[model samples]
Target: MRDGVRPPLRNHHEEAAEELGTTTKRDTINTALREVTARYRRLRALEEAREPAADGALDMDLLLDKRAYRPRGADSATDDHGTGADG
Candidate 1:
């Protein structure tokens, strides 16, 4: 690949190519195909395991409470601990 000729890896194929460290078109396409197939296999395994991993006593409403847990004066970007809200 030419220096300063590469564009931003906005698409999956480009991103996969970058991740695989391949410069050639054939290598990039092969890497992308491998990534997609690997992803599909992972998703299929998750789907197959879903039924066996189900918990009957799990409470979604209690576990997933939507109420904000910010302490007083935590409305600002950072808290007293100097950590941002996102942290």
Candidate 2:
């Protein structure tokens, strides 16, 4: 009961997407992608840091996965348009 505050409701994604002229699925995908990518990076580092108990120590995959939507490295590609949209 504030001057302009409103009660919280469920499914805010739909309302936000409608206001932004987008689909809720797209937002969900974006959020999930970001979270997964971050988690993968963190997990990978953690796995690599753990010491092996015996002499069978090997490099851990660390569960790091390449991002599907990521662009190429700045040195690997050229950008004539000055915009990264091409990558």
Candidate 3:
């Protein structure tokens, strides 16, 4: 109700940011930041519970081509082209 002091915004940061626009005061932003941090902590806790690993990873999608990773040239001293091995 007071003009000089700011009223707290609703829970949504994006909406609050839009309503506050560029001229947002410190208190309103601090409130929003606290809410965001709490939510992130909760989500991180859930993710950690889902992943038993200490690093919090499970069923990762990985791509590996053994042939591509290792070169055919490594098997022998000969080159792919007609160049002599002694040369």
- lDDT winner: 1
Give the number of the best model, judged by TM-score. 1
lDDT per residue for candidate 1 within 44-75, as digits (tens), equals 99777665556545454655675544455555
Total residue pair clashes for candidate 3: 0
lDDT of 3 by residue, 1-87 (tens): 478865555435556766646335565687667888999999999787667644645433322355544546642434544464555
Q: Per-candidate RMSD vs. true structure?
A: 11.5, 12.2, 12.0
Q: Please, what are the lDDT tens digits per residue for candidate 2 over residues 1-87? A: 358976564456666556556566777557657778999999988776665613456433433445443557774344644655566
Local distance difference test, each candidate: 0.70, 0.61, 0.61
Error of 3 at 60 (Å): 22
Per-residue error at 82 for model 3, in Å?
96
> Which pairs in model 1 have colliding backbones?
none
On TM-score, the stronger of 2 and 3 is 3
